[model samples]
Target: MKTDKKKIIVSVTNDLVSDNRVHKVCTTLYSMGFEVLLVGRILPHSSEVKRQYSTKRFQLLFKKGPCFYAEYNFRLFLYLLFAKYDILLSNDLDSLTGNFVASQLRNKPLVYDSHEYFIEVPELVHRPKIQSIWLWLEQKILPKIQYAYTVCQSIADVYNKEYGTDFKIVRNLPLKQNYKPAEKQSDEKIILYQGALNIGRGLEQAIKAMNNIDGVKLVIAGDGDIREQLHDLVLQEKLHDKIQFAGRLPLEELAKLTATADLGLSIEEDLGLNYRFALPNKLFDYIQSQVPVLVTNLPEMAAIVKKYDVGEITDSLEPKQLADKFREALFNEKKRKVWKEKLPFAAKELVWEKEEKVIQEIFKGITR
Candidate 1:
């Protein structure tokens, strides 16, 4: 099914190897026999990740420094102009400017994938003027684009209602279903937390909950700006034995560890609409692994968790209340079994496979 036609150019703002969206999308495109000219930043080499597709990286000179949005856009614009691609796929607002320019120059279709609500980003939440600028840009740019998509149904509806644009829903689901090991250690019930270690992500609550509970261990498997702060909090609370920082393990290793976990955690504070409606990849990761969850009481998350009866949900922000719910989830085997029963359905229905046809239809619309 391989075609000799020109490749699709997908631009991303982050390191491609580590980011879930870029990594999964590139793999999916390769599987569907599309030549993907992936443009991203190159990270330090690690034997852990062996990428499967061809990529054209614009490696940034400084690894750690202040935000260089202008510099990044200029470099990416030059690269996109020279790359000569048939279709332009922009990951987020960060790279949208370059993609928009490239699409106009080359007369190619542009696909914008909004992963998060940029206006409500934690950093920009307090700054009204900055948020206004982002909103203005989105209003100016999003309408002219022919194809658009987002992570969840709620976000898609928001875009459709606000911008009068039709956006396809593409949930960030896991690629496979896995079973728990035959013999998992019952002594240490592993409570798993992954994704960026940010404030209002319910990590502080997860840490605080451990203060009251015993015989439970938490494995934090990712890194972020707040990681060191969380580590310091764990030390301050003297819950060293109960909490462990796995420090950004490889995807394969993280999956294996997830399979062994007793419960998965995806609780975000309702600080913004984006966090309020998040259906995180880790939630599906837990489902694929057949582990129940302790999720927040957000409507979007609650719809799935309550539908499947897979885990518990709480709107309470209190640490003690969260701990009590965790205790109940850990102890009640019957309640957990109800959630586990939906594993096969959750695995099959809630994946990227569901979005492929919708994506194809959008492409057909643009091409016609």
Candidate 2:
């Protein structure tokens, strides 16, 4: 029963449990008749992933810092060098080097999906030498990639201009669902922030803003490096009653939680190119759940918010301003109704069913 089908190997740097984007992509590729194997590393705290397609997670010695990257890439290179795959799919710049080298050595096509502007991440903003290394790697490998896609147009434009490579945009939209709006729990409003609890995400300001607003609870439903610090901030501000952390729910539970919220927040600070251009998946989740949003006035996010009239966009990240905006979004019944009315159409438009066609076309081109 050995059927002849093209096998694709996709690599990323995160534990695969909560990566809805990667899961969607892999599922699409599987449905399209490609034998897909999604690869990632297993951390000490990594949870078990239940996927439709095959997955392989390497358990490495080092889990963070330079050693981690080096060890993971070296191990990945070896794995890709020997493993059977017709196409190599690299998730981001961090996983590109090994995949690119393996593809070149094996004479297979390499498809890169840049999740963000890697060199312009907040983590690398202060580290010049490390940033330079990433930049060098990107410059070296990008020119060789024949099939490439990114999460958004702004990021794709930067890649195209910088490397003279045409990268297609396949946004990280939510899958179409038969969504019914959840009934509100009580008069106390729920303000939600659902993504990586990382630096430059404006979580600190959001927490601080909660102090100024009353009769509302802030629920943060994700985990990252700064989770401890954020918890400490909540304690220091004495906003324990106002702020609660629901660390890293699965996509299903997250969607349910999103539906229950009065307002969704994506207040990313403009600390780097990636942050400025970020059209986070949580925004789409909010839209799909028919919840209003309060986003930062960044180009990618603001355009959608304005176009669909989903919510308000603020130019300032100040606590007072954020608190005021939150109050307005929550208490402004007329405006909230208008935003809710637009959500169905926005949800219909922004979905995986529409975006997957572009992915199918790109893979068809690659296979041809």
Candidate 3:
């Protein structure tokens, strides 16, 4: 028997080890009979990727800044130009230029997945000249994109209004799992903050809040540019005994670690539009693990916290304010129990199984 399934190429800018969303998307597409080849650039520190679908990581000379983006996109453009792909999936704006140009030249369908508002990211906030380049790229490419999707409805609305493109909303939700939440092993509660240790993540405030938050250990997982700085901050505050940096862990390992935590934190500062409209995967990850969360009162996050009654939302990122909120959430056993009780219902609605159907239907409509 011969099956004729379309071949799809998915592109991203990061090494694929910690990208749970992209991995889930590729898995779903593979199950639907698509021959998937996930593409990304390799850094000197990138770990070997082992997966069921084919993956390629291009080694480039430059590692950061404009040089890296230009070189990587050029290589990606050349690769996509010559490769045999029925559909090209570009993840985020950084990868869009290469995929867009290649898709246009090759006359293949291109699906744009906007993970965040690229031009509004914190990195670009200080550099206007550099920001202009990305803004221009987005302005030119976005209107021409036939099919697009974003991680949240807020971002989707922004794109629709800005570019007149009908972008669908497919949230970056966690995969459904059967593992039961681990019982607290230690007397001290674990306060976990997972994901990239990047700026504008309110980590400084979180670390400062630890001074007031006793009988709890702050566990900072994942790696980013500010990891060393954060470590220094912990040491300077003389809170090394109370704070632990787990670095980056594989998604499976991270899940196991997340399950043990008593409370999860996602206190993204309102620095830009991207953070304002942000709906990070860790929020859902916390829910899936049946852990109560204490998130900042941003639109997307606040809406989830309010609607599901799964966690508390803090109004301020000030250390004292955050500390007060953490104390309230951690010590209030009745509230914590109530929040944990709602996790099953929240998890059912937020899992990737339901979201995958949207991706499948979109492909069915576009490919046919």
RMSD to truth, every model: 2.1, 1.6, 1.3
Q: How many residue pairs clash in each candidate?
A: 1, 0, 0
Q: What's the TM-score of every candidate structure?
A: 0.93, 0.98, 0.98
Alpha-carbon lDDT of model 2: 0.91
Candidate lDDT scores, in order, read 0.79, 0.91, 0.91
lDDT score for residue 271 of model 2: 88
lDDT of 1 by residue, 238-286 (tens): 9999999987777888888888888889988898888888888889888
* Cα TM-score of candidate 1: 0.93
lDDT of prediction 1: 0.79
Off by over 4 Å in 2: 1-3
Q: Candidate 1: RMSD over Cα atoms?
A: 2.1
Instruction: Please report how far candidate 2 places residue 147 from its true position, in Å.
Output: 0.6
On lDDT, who's better, 1 or 2?
2
**Candidate 1 vs 3: which has more lDDT:** 3
Better of 1 and 3 by TM-score: 3
What candidate 1 gets wrong by more than 4 Å, as runs, is 43-49, 61-67, 178-182, 364-368
